[model samples]
Target chain A: MIPSSWYLILSAVLFTMGVAGFLIKRSLITVFMSIELMLNAVNLSFVTFAHDWHAVKGQIFVFFVMMVAAAEAAVGLAIIIAIFRTRQTLNVDQIDLMKF
Target chain B: MHLALFLIFAAVALAGAANLLLQKHPINAALSLIVVMSSLAVLYLLLGAEFLAIAQIIVYAGAIMVLFTFVIMLLNEGVEEKTHGSRVAKLLGFPAVTVFLALIASIILSSETHLGKVIIGESITTTQDLSAVLFRDLLLPFEITSVLILIAILGAVALARKDEQ
Candidate 1:
């Protein structure tokens, strides 16, 4: 019997890695992937809690989260394409027109 | 057997995440994320979320990753160029994030939250069981998500289309 906390600990670790990638990486696509990683990590936590609580609602929440992630990815990638078209670069630093 | 399998997949997921961070090219990072997503699906299976496990694979690994790869191919993005980032970001960012996450991990481990053990192959949440709660108690949210997906599709097409001007 594996301790549920181990799953949570793993989730935390994965989420941390996602944050690190988000902070360190410069490319927009990779940064977007990092956001997905973080979402996946949270999904793992939701599943773990679902298992422990013997409730289906947690899994239901995971489903909703996945749905939102899909929608976000669709709109977000389109925005990325639009940005790439205008700025002609995927680097975040150079896309600082709004940075003032 | 369960513990061993858990360890193996967990290690694979962690490694894939690290690879996603380390790889400079967007394509390689995207591939690494696929590895992470697949291994996560396996983890979900081990946790007895069968519907979620399959959904994770189909939605994330199958559909989402293909979309990411497609965009990468369309853009023809090259390897990332190393830039001399701000001294604060380069020097303090990694260490700050490392310390913060370490704090969070320690808090989680040390707290008395009482997250019980997960015995594998027991108490599986079946697809029928899920849909019962989903379609009945959560019917409104379910319909709302359909609307959300519709809007997302429209938004994607609108945003990505070439401008007439």
Candidate 2:
């Protein structure tokens, strides 16, 4: 059997990569994609824990997390589109209206 | 057999993540993200979290990735001239990322010391058990969270549209 630790390690690696990407990438779309990666990484760990504990709570929690992710995506995309229209660009450095 | 399969999935995930990082195009990154997400779903399945696996496929690979792709397409944000960070930022970021990764690796290693053997075994792999717990014990938060998500969605749309008027 593949050890549960392997899955957790992989999840951690993936999450770190996602975090690095989110912090380093300048493209708004790329940043959004990185955020998705982070979420998927979390799901991997959650499932791993669910399987280990013999309880279904973690799986159910994953279901709810997925639901929230869907809604977040819909709303996030709309905001991205709106910003794109106003700025005519999606570069992170260029959009500084909200920055003090 | 399971180890071999897990290795394969892990390899695919790494490749997808590399593509996400290396490709300059937003759409390509989004597609790679989907590959990574689907491989994660497979990992979930192998772990006996069938409901979570299906949910990962549907919500992440199906819904979220598609939304990302659509947004990338909608914006027509082609791979414009690649923007480089300032020299100072690049120099600082390299050390910062290295330290961060090191810290995470240490934390993970420390946690491994306390991990006991997996206990659930093969008996807990059914959908019925998951549904029962979800519907019975966690029903309230489940419903409330859905409502909260709905409100967030509406707020996002409203915020995005308000500028048009």
Candidate 3:
């Protein structure tokens, strides 16, 4: 039988990559996607722990996370669209209107 | 048997995520994310989360990603421009991340024995139990989430349209 540690480890690796991408990528959409990737990695860890403990609460938590992610995505992308309309650019570095 | 399946899908998911990071075009990156999400759905199935697996596909891969692509089209932002790579990120960031990965890998591998193996259930019995818990224990949070989604939809509609003076 495969140990649950493997799944957890993979989740860690994915989470780290998401962090790396979030820092390394400049595009707003790519950064946004990295956030989703991070969420998915967390979901994987939750499922791993759930399976190890034989509990359904982990999956239920994953459900809540997905719901929140969906809402975040809708609002986030709409904001991105609005930003692009005004600034005519999608680069987070270039779209720095908040910086003084 | 299951190990091989897990490894294959894990590899695909990892590769797809890597592709998402490296691709220059947002659309290409978005597609790679979809690949990652789909592979993750299969892994969820293997872990006995039958309902979550299907929901992962339907909600994340199906709806969220389509919204991303739609926004991409609506914005019409072309390929990402080259940034003046941050000097701090270059000198310290990449190596720091590598060290972080190594640290996590050692921690996980060293503690492997403490964590128990997942006993795979033969039948798809998770859906019924999941629903039971979700409905009975989590009904309040579930209703609040639906309300959150409604607010999000309204917000998106308001935000995406042309603003009036």
Candidate 4:
């Protein structure tokens, strides 16, 4: 039997790596991928908790989270494409039109 | 057996995530993310979330990653340029994150005793049970998510098309 907390710890480590990628990466697409990483980490924990408690709701919640992630990814990539079309650059630093 | 399997895949997932961070190109990062997602699916399988594991593979590794890869190829973007970034963030960011990670790990380890253990193939949530809960208990959210996907589709179309004069 593997302790469920180990899964949670792995999730946390993945989440932190996602955070680091999001903060440190310069490209728009890579940062977006970091967001996806964070979402996946959370899904792991949700499944872990569900298994720990022998409840199905956690998995159900993961399902919904995945749905939301899909929707978000579609719209976000579209927005990235739009920004790239106009800006002609994928760098987040260069795409800062609203920055004062 | 379960512990060994979990450790192996967890290591794979962590390595993938680290590579995602280290890769300078978006396509490479995206591919690494796929590795992480696949390993995570294996982890989910070990935890007996069979349906979710499959969904993770099909939805994440298959559909979403394809979308990401397509966008990367369509953009034809090159490697990421290095920026010095903000000095304050450089000074404080990693340490802050390390502190946060330590705090979270300590809390989880403290509660590890009672949080219980998961045996491989112990409690399988069949598709029927999953669908019953999804369609019956959470029907409204289910329908709403459909609408959300529709909105997403429409938004993507609107966003991607060229603006008319």
Model 2 Cα shift for residue A11 (angstroms)? 0.6
lDDT of 1: 0.90
Q: How close is candidate 4 to the true structure, as a TM-score?
A: 0.97
Residue lDDT tens for model 2, B1-165: 677778999889978987887778888888889899888877776787776777788888887888788778777888834455534434666677678767866776777756534432464467788878878899898879878787877877686675534
| Chain B structural similarity as TM-score, candidate 1 | 0.93
DockQ of each: 0.77, 0.58, 0.73, 0.78
Candidate 1 chain A least-lDDT 10 residues: A91-100
- Candidate 3 docks at the CAPRI level of medium
Full ranking by TM-score:
4, 1, 3, 2
Q: Chain A: TM-score in each candidate?
A: 0.97, 0.95, 0.96, 0.96
Q: Is candidate 1 or candidate 3 better by TM-score?
A: 1
- Give the per-residue lDDT of model 2 (tens digit) for A1-100: 7567778878878887787777666788898888878888888888887777766777787788788788878787887888887889888777778766
How would you encode candidate 4's per-residue C-alpha lDDT over B65-164 as one tens digit per residue? 9999999999998999886663344466788878878998998999999898888888988888899888999999999888999999999999998988
Question: What 10-residue stretch in candidate 1 chain B is worst by lDDT?
Answer: B81-90
Q: Clash totals for all models, in order?
A: 0, 0, 0, 0
- Candidate 1, clashing residue pairs? none
The whole-model lDDT of each prediction reads 0.90, 0.77, 0.87, 0.91
DockQ of 4: 0.78
Candidate 1 lDDT tens digits, B1-165: 999999999999999999999999999999999999999999999999999999998899888888899999999988876766533455878898789788978877886267788888898999999999999999999999999999999999999999798
Quote each prediction's TM-score: 0.96, 0.90, 0.94, 0.97
